[model samples]
Target: MAPKVLIVLTSQATISSVDKPTGWYLPEFAHPYYKLAGKCDITIASPAGGEAPLDQGSVKMFEGDEECQKFLKEESSLWKKTEKLESFKGKASQFDAIFYVGGHGPMFDLANSAISHDIIREFYESSKVVSAVCHGPAALVNAKLSDGSYLIAGQQVTGFSNTEEDQVGMSKAMPFMLETDLKKNSGSDSLFVAAAEPWGSKVVVSGKNGKLITGQNPASAGPVGEALLQALGA
Candidate 1:
């Protein structure tokens, strides 16, 4: 039987105070969704159940991406029924792994919700795959493990770097710098990594069998999925 994989997305539809549309990055979810769908049973969820919004920029950025295009054409069934994160009260053992999808929206809600932290912490402590990409790492912020330690502490991590945020000219628009927050909150065991170039692809995996995996930017989305597959023993 294929391992069950849960894909978490941000339901926050708008960028905080920016008046710009924001939600789950399309390719971040799409590429990963496609890559793992065949190898695992996938389910989608969000802070608030129902439909999760899409980032307009991601749609434009991956307009020609084959996997992304398939997602667009199959949008209705592929994405419309995300479960509410609060509803999943079972232990992390319920699934083989969990993935956090990114966008400017996650930087707003996922970063603030204690629910997100608990979910991520449960998965992390259970020795299961706990992965995030780009702004998706926002969900990992402040997530506490059972020993009263931060989840990403002393682990290698990579997310949307500060340089990329500034390059996009949304530094002031976001709640905080993703890379900076990780660096500041990460414990002695954590090593926050950054990509060499703005918008470049970078995936960092830490812990046993790559328990913790993160991707740097939109370009890292697909590769992050690939990494997850390997981590899952595909």
Candidate 2:
């Protein structure tokens, strides 16, 4: 049987402070979803269980990306109805991995969600894969292990960088800088790696069997999916 993978997306539709619409980024979800489509039993889900919103900004940004456009035209329905994150509580064993999709929206909602933390803990404690990209790492911000230790503590990881946030002029608008929070949770700055420059592809894989994985920015989305596949032996 193929490995079962659950892809979590943010439900928050807008960045209220900036008066900008935000949710999961198109490339982040499209790249990964297509990569794992035929190889795994994949389910797209969100905190609210209904339609998970899309970041309109990503649509304009990735308008020329062939794969991203393909997904938008054909597979857009995949996110139209998502399973509720709560529905999977205590069911981590049923899946081989959990992937969090990224966008600025996750920084606001998933970052502070107790249920998101609990669900991630369920997957992590089960020795299953816990992965994310860009702002998706927001889901892992304060998530702790059964021992009460922050999950990312002592774990090598990467996500949307502080510089990237500033480059986009969203640093002040974001509730917290993803890179900074990840470093804090990691208990050190060196553990939170980054690419040579902003908007570059950087994926970090840690933990036994490379179960804990993360990507630095939108450019790293597809590679993160590939890493997840390799980790699952798929």
Cα RMSDs of all predictions? Answer: 1.6, 0.7
Residue pairs in clash, model 1: 153-187, 153-189, 153-190, 154-189, 154-190, 155-189, 155-190
lDDT of 2 by residue, 21-109 (tens): 88999999999888899999998889998899999999999999999999999987789989899989889999999999999989988
Q: Which is the leading candidate under lDDT?
A: 2
Q: lDDT for model 2, on a 0 to 1 scale?
A: 0.92
Q: Cα lDDT for residue 66, model 2?
A: 99
Name the top TM-score candidate: 2
Query: Residue-wise lDDT of candidate 1 within 1-234, one digit each (tens)?
Result: 898888888888876476888888888988888789779988888988888888878889889888888888886565578898987656578888899999988898888788878888778778889999999999987787878887877778889988888988899998788888798777532477776668879999887667999999989999999999988897
The worst-scoring run of ten residues by lDDT in candidate 2 lies at 172-181
Q: Which residue runs of candidate 1 sit more than 4 Å off their true CA positions?
A: 188-190
lDDT of each candidate versus the true structure: 0.84, 0.92
